[model samples]
Target: MSGFVAGGPPPSGQTSPDGHINTSPFWPSIDLDALRGTLRLDNSISPPRLETAVIAAAISVNRELAAWRIEQQAAGYSKLEEVPGETVKGVPEQVHLYRRAIEAATGAEVCERYRSYDTTNSGGKKADDIAPNIDDYRRDLRWAIRDFLGTTRTTVELI
Candidate 1:
């Protein structure tokens, strides 16, 4: 994985000690074999596709947090290095949140199927076709990234 360049926080994301961050991979090089157990996925089936999705999701998650880092920096955070994943709001288990980011990006879903037509009753019951769902990640991703860096959430009293 030579060019497996995880975008180590975008430039706008934040500055680090000496204007450089710990360029080490935020998470270890994901071992698909190991993730199989944690993710409850069996490798005997389509491992390549699953692995690719997970890797892509991880990169996406990193990029998302990079933006949050930038915002945190602008909000007057100096010691940014001390902040990432420090068990703050919106992030309980950092690793678990990363897993969720993967699931969100890939739109991993489980649903029961139903076959029926629209129904309406004059005064008893009513049903209609549903509007399409837009794949918006802004809120959910930010919620996951809230504690990825310095000072994500704060309040000040003005007098």
Candidate 2:
């Protein structure tokens, strides 16, 4: 058998075990395992790449929400999780939105990186297939951020 089998699990130690990636003081930490499972990310994604993508996403999300966060803090809400939102199974909805935003952003980042990772014909075809996904991922990220900010996703302005 060849060294690499299609659909086979990646060799061990390619990714980290279940763990947490700490966020800023005002944000909830992200669970690495949850992110991987929720996004259906396979072992093909290396740990370093996954971590880098996630950190980049979090930084982007945090920067995008910085103004709102400051306002919330001035209003006596010091943490993103403390913002008023419906709870699911005792977990705040804002937390879900935040994670969703990160996941979507990470997906986009991964897709973008993958597109440039290979130049072979198969790789090109795969990149083409995923081209639309990048947009969708970005859209989802925007919606999630909007939801977290309690803003409407669309703003239809008359021309």
Question: Largest TM-score belongs to which candidate?
Answer: 2
Q: Which 10 successive residues of model 1 have the least lDDT summed? A: 109-118
TM-score of each: 0.38, 0.86
Encode model 1's per-residue lDDT on 64-118: one tens digit a residue: 6776546656776543333454564554355555554554443331000000222
Model 2 CA deviation exceeding 4 Å by range: 1-11
> What overall lDDT goes with each candidate model?
0.40, 0.81
Every model: Cα RMSD to truth: 14.9, 4.6
Model 1 spans with C-alpha error above 4 angstroms = 1-24, 69-95, 103-143, 146-159
Residue-level lDDT of model 2, residues 1-159, one tens digit each, is 011123434466765565667777888888777787666666777778889999999999999988888898899997877888799988899888889999999889988887877799988987888888888899999999999888999999899
Residue pairs with backbone atoms closer than 3 Å in model 1 (clashes): 13-69, 13-70
